[model samples]
Target chain A: MNLPQPLQELIDQFESLPGIGRKSAAKLAFYLLNVPQDRLNRFSQALTDLKVKTHKCDRCFNLTENKRCSLCEDEGRDQSLLCVVEEVTDLLVIEQTRKFNGLYHVLYGRIDPLNNLGPEEILAPQLLSRLVKEGGKIKEIILATNPNMEGETTAMYLKSKLEELRTKKSLDFKISRLAYGLPMGASLEYADYGTLIQALDHRNGF
Target chain B: MNLPQPLQELIDQFESLPGIGRKSAAKLAFYLLNVPQDRLNRFSQALTDLKVKTHKCDRCFNLTENKRCSLCEDEGRDQSLLCVVEEVTDLLVIEQTRKFNGLYHVLYGRIDPLNNLGPEEILAPQLLSRLVKEGGKIKEIILATNPNMEGETTAMYLKSKLEELRTKKSLDFKISRLAYGLPMGASLEYADYGTLIQALDHRNGF
Candidate 1:
């Protein structure tokens, strides 16, 4: 008697996604319905496959299809330098440039006290442990976390924690945060390629 | 040395969706990777199931799981009055109010000559045949097509065609169109419920 219940249900599901409101969700649902059955199937399968086939690298926390991420497994990469980011997408953006030969550590999220997300909620502990355990091979740690309030706070927290680890172990590896010339509050994912490259070039000691 | 090739491919596919764009698509793809496998499967299956489960109603051309749409099958509906719309989504909007007990005919699209979409492209022939085939049981045809140029042109074309049909059959039935006091160039999907109801109430004979 009304819109097919399944169609409405799907539209509601889409609306629940981040950045999608009611109107956009409805349009997306209708567009999906109109797509060819094969394309829809492929799109759906891709969503399911993303979860089934991919996982966080135990070492760096970047998404991977194997036990360790491609960066960690690649012998040609500069193992002495590591770039840390807030999410896997950030890693992908940096990777697209073909400039960074270092490994990456995905925090999975940034520290947001307002959202009840703290240092422990992210992969901070694991990242610190990896740096300490592999202190001999890694000469520098690049804090490429996003240039936002939460990102700055998280970077500061990690910097202090890594400093404590270095003092306790008598290690001398350098730790640095990304440059702040980028527009404030802008996500690393949306930063222009040139801005990201410039930020990476101007990174300084934390 | 980066995100897996398949994962990158999947993100590119998400970007291809309408209104998804690059940044939002990456977010969605990453979100998909983070979601539980079972939940991702359900979302993916829903996408494919939407098109597979729904089919055009033979009688009204509305999206339905059966031969006749729920509105057409309902016993309480006033079969004497029919509300014609451009799409199934539009029909759903009117049905949400529970005020119109009449049946519906979905033309699927309007007559857009500029886009090479004419009457034959949107099931107009079937609509006219249905009106004539209903015999004297149908007393009124309410045109609830949109208010855009294509909508207006389609309504006028349908009005002239229906008039010819009435003259040929020697029948007496009122033909009307929903009022246009609402804003122009806005889709029926975006119209508030109150506005749509008022437009229906103030409908004028074509």
Candidate 2:
């Protein structure tokens, strides 16, 4: 026999999520059947509030509940050095490292030509306008997008645009992309070919 | 900076689910952020209805929206044969095989001494009462519980109780257990010692 309507609907919703299969979805639905009513209600409330209670930062496009994100509002952050990333999650990952004191610009996506995404599809225009508005105050713009092909394409596109703007508008910010090499603690035996080549080309002086 | 409150709560809820880690929870929460408002609402509604709109089948303990589950209400099924399982999920698994037309009894859980669960903690008493109610109608009782320790304990306990009831009430049902052997597609080299021993003990005629 088929599952009850409510259970079936919940299973279908769970299956629609990334990486969850039909069996896993049904398992989750079954597990939730025994959860306390209040906890289930809280989970449902959180789902409803996830989109309703949050908005994007006006300046950087990072997620926020207020007019601007905490990173954007903090005056202690280094405004002169901005890091541009492809998504809010990437910004959060960098923030967790506690190494970056500068503000961030969330591009929302990368330049994926295979999927019909271009520079225009991302927040490239917004980044340029923001830079133009900031003028000479920002000394450096870090392209911290992912290190894949689409990320490389986005960084290259942004770099050329920033260089053209530097000459045309007399901007003073230097553009830089994230360094490429073997990840820390990763063995050379397992490292991919592209990473090995990049490591050799960008070898640090002893 | 930490995630927004609503997003963080959703992530925490996702993390509480079995097999979902912190990173996967965050990924699911972020993925849902982009889901359409209507879909999100539907997902939220489903979660609310999962518990509120469904209940245990009065006769068999399987999950159902109505008083009696479809399995119990069906007149075409073989009421004389009853298969006792540990959970509703197991009943569904057996039903998916489509080999059994018999009615089912869900024990809800198994006896586990490590967890302090006894025969009374499960639906053993309920099963006895149901057998008494059915009396001589049920011709055979299949112990279809899992082959694990707790399942074995539950089945053993139920068998003794059924034997006592059969003597007292003069019920004519014969009790039986599912066979133990190698699973269909499992290789002999990889099969565990217990399975190999069981397969040897229960060798079938060619």
Candidate 3:
């Protein structure tokens, strides 16, 4: 109850975050107590620069400090393939799979009407313009949003929008969604009903 | 893959703390991006002051910014009783119980032999000096260390040390340990064997 002011404030700030609880907040505040003043200053500087120095990439809406993100500037990656992800972290997850070697479009968030979030709230227009401006370069657009309800809605909306662009400009690029199936190492008995239905509906001969 | 410098640094710092992993680190970094610049400044200031402003209280070794912690300075608290704990956070946990009205002596850490931590590494000497200074005023000493092996070892060591001090000063005070029992709402089948044995050994009148 008589915790020092700054320590208590730090704990309060930590508690305000998404997953941190009261015990963890206290642990972190006390753990930070042992860190030297110089390290604390560096941490503070990092926090200050976290918001001040970072901005969304103009082209891809990915996090970056420059006019464009590194992925967009890198000429080594495949330019004809574009992966659309719900957030920059999803792009990171895709990158970790080491299977996708193309550019990315970060939507920043998905459309969820129940949560009062609409197309205008996110980076939907940026994605539209990027598609329009770079139509000739991109050959395939992969919709990699989450497989949940909101993600399905966003994917459908983007699919229609991409379809309209393709028809209007007669773009040669293909619009595709990630396939549904039981994940690797998953058992069939425990698989969700909708996923199993999708897998059955889209089954292919080996 | 293309995270900016400051955001990456903050993520790395967050990852270095206990219990935080890579995914949570990135989530925290990106979440901090949405926090306003003024709020970020306050959070940064709190980090700056966490170590710089806090030090161990000279009397009880509880964390404080002043000469003595508020608990030690409070005249309303029972001055005749003192609770010895392994760390300041342990004292906080006991405070949450709202059953203890005595002062506390924080040893700062348990005797973790596997981690190369011993009595000398923590505030054991400070506790000894405090006991010597205030032995006449204190009538009861409670060893409130954890119930695990290391905690039991630390409490035994402290008990012997306190017994030596009591013999040297001919101190007239009682030393006690917390009662062993089945905790409220704990299932008998789920209780560990050692705890169950201790409960049986310390069984009192029904």
| TM-scores for every predicted model | 0.81, 0.96, 0.91
Q: Can you write out model 2's per-residue Cα lDDT over A25-101, one digit (the tens) per residue?
A: 99999999999988889899999889999899889999988879999899999989999999998999999999999
Q: Per-prediction TM-score, chain A only? A: 0.80, 0.97, 0.95
Residues B11-60, model 3: lDDT tens digits: 99899989999889989988998878998898899899888788778888
Looking at model 2, the pairs that clash are none
**Poorest 10 consecutive residues of model 1 chain B by lDDT?**
B1-10
On residues A106-192, what C-alpha lDDT tens digit does candidate 1 reach at each position? 898999999999988999999878877886788888998877679888999989998898899888789997655567798998988
- Across B134-177, the per-residue lDDT of candidate 2 in tens digits comes to 77889999999999888998899999999999999999999999
Model 3: per-residue Cα lDDT over A128-152, one tens digit each: 7887887688999999999999999
The lDDT of each candidate is 0.82, 0.93, 0.88
What fraction of the real A-B contacts shows up in model 2?
0.80
Candidate 2 wrong stretches, greater than 4 Å? none
Order of candidate numbers by TM-score, starting with the best: 2, 3, 1
Compute the DockQ of candidate 1: 0.47
lDDT of residue A84 for candidate 3: 93
